[model samples]
Target: MNTNDATRATAETMPDLFALASSMEDDMHKVSDLAFLINDYLTRGDRITLEMQQALCWPASELVEVGRKLRAHSVALYAASKRPATLLNEETRP
Candidate 1:
């Protein structure tokens, strides 16, 4: 219905921030491991096959896009956290 109602509904359905942060941290570690492995392969003096190149390219691009989204989310969350609760509630009210 109204903006306030919509915001309340969304908040009701949102996941716990602590759990989400933990999961994200775990995923980032996995990504870091993947980066280390890729770096090792690149520096090991072994020729990279076309298939390996193709596989890495897709994930690298996806990672870049994911990183952009993560950065945007982090910035928005930080900004929201800095604002007063009254201000946030007023902004959401219709």
Candidate 2:
């Protein structure tokens, strides 16, 4: 298939699979950390306008979904990194 057709097919089949599969751990971690930093700002009575707050608002469900995906990706990556390559091939190893 052509590039456009291939892209369309993949998107149609898996939707956001690429996003869910890619590592966003660092970015997500920064977001989580920034939340704490922002709390400090709020504690200092730094005004966050209603429009700004509205712009920053994210749904809990969406955050939960991304967090879950990121966690699963991290676990898979850790296992792949720590496990012996020999164990991946049963016939070759044993």
Candidate 3:
């Protein structure tokens, strides 16, 4: 596709991309909340298994990674959206 076509396509999809990222962020928050609940439960118990701690730690770590990636993607999207139209022109780039 031509540059204009590509730009139009990107513009059209930006909202959906942002929405999906936002949804993932919301899901990550839920995961964090669940982890907190699990920790609370474990603390109230007389004994906690290593495996149970690992179970909570793994998802929480994964959520942190996912959140990092989402933030990076959001930054990229914002940067792309802010680029001057001239920069997207084929003749303008080195």
Candidate 4:
């Protein structure tokens, strides 16, 4: 299809795109909440044992990584929405 057709098609899918973005944002919020909880648990006055703290360290780090990835994806999605022609061209490239 030509550029106009491609752009029109992208426009038609805008609602779905927005929904997906919204879902991603919700997921990011949930991830943030979990990270906050983990941080609170790890930092709260010495109620937990050292072993428990050590066990949480890895998961906490993983959550941070996940949050970063989610944020990056969200930004990418926003960028794509702002330039549908560019996104369409990139997708169809061999």
Model 1, residue 76: distance off in Å is 0.9
List where candidate 4 sits over 4 angstroms from the true fold. 1-58
Best by lDDT: 4
Better of 1 and 3 by lDDT: 3
Question: How much is the lDDT of residue 94 in candidate 1?
Answer: 83
For candidate 4, the 10 contiguous residues with the lowest summed lDDT are: 44-53
Clashes of each: 0, 0, 0, 0
Residue 60 of model 1, lDDT score: 52
lDDT of 3 at 10: 73
When 1 and 2 are scored with lDDT, the better candidate is 1
1-65, model 4: which lDDT tens digit per residue? 88889778787657646765776765566555456354554355324434443654545445455
User: After TM-score superposition, what is the CA distance of residue 10 in candidate 3 from its true location, in Å?
Assistant: 0.3
User: lDDT: which is higher, 1 or 4?
Assistant: 4
lDDT of 1 by residue, 16-39 (tens): 333335545643654464564555
Give all candidates' CA lDDT scores. Answer: 0.52, 0.48, 0.55, 0.58
**Residue pairs with clashing backbones, model 4:** none
Question: Please, what is the TM-score per model?
Answer: 0.39, 0.37, 0.35, 0.42
lDDT of 2 by residue, 1-94 (tens): 6888656554543423334345565546635644644444335343443433444475544444544565577676565444443343342343
Point out the higher-scoring one by TM-score: 3 or 4.
4
Clashing residue pairs, backbone N/CA/C < 3 A, model 2: none
**Positional deviation of residue 26's Cα in model 1 after best superposition, in angstroms:** 13
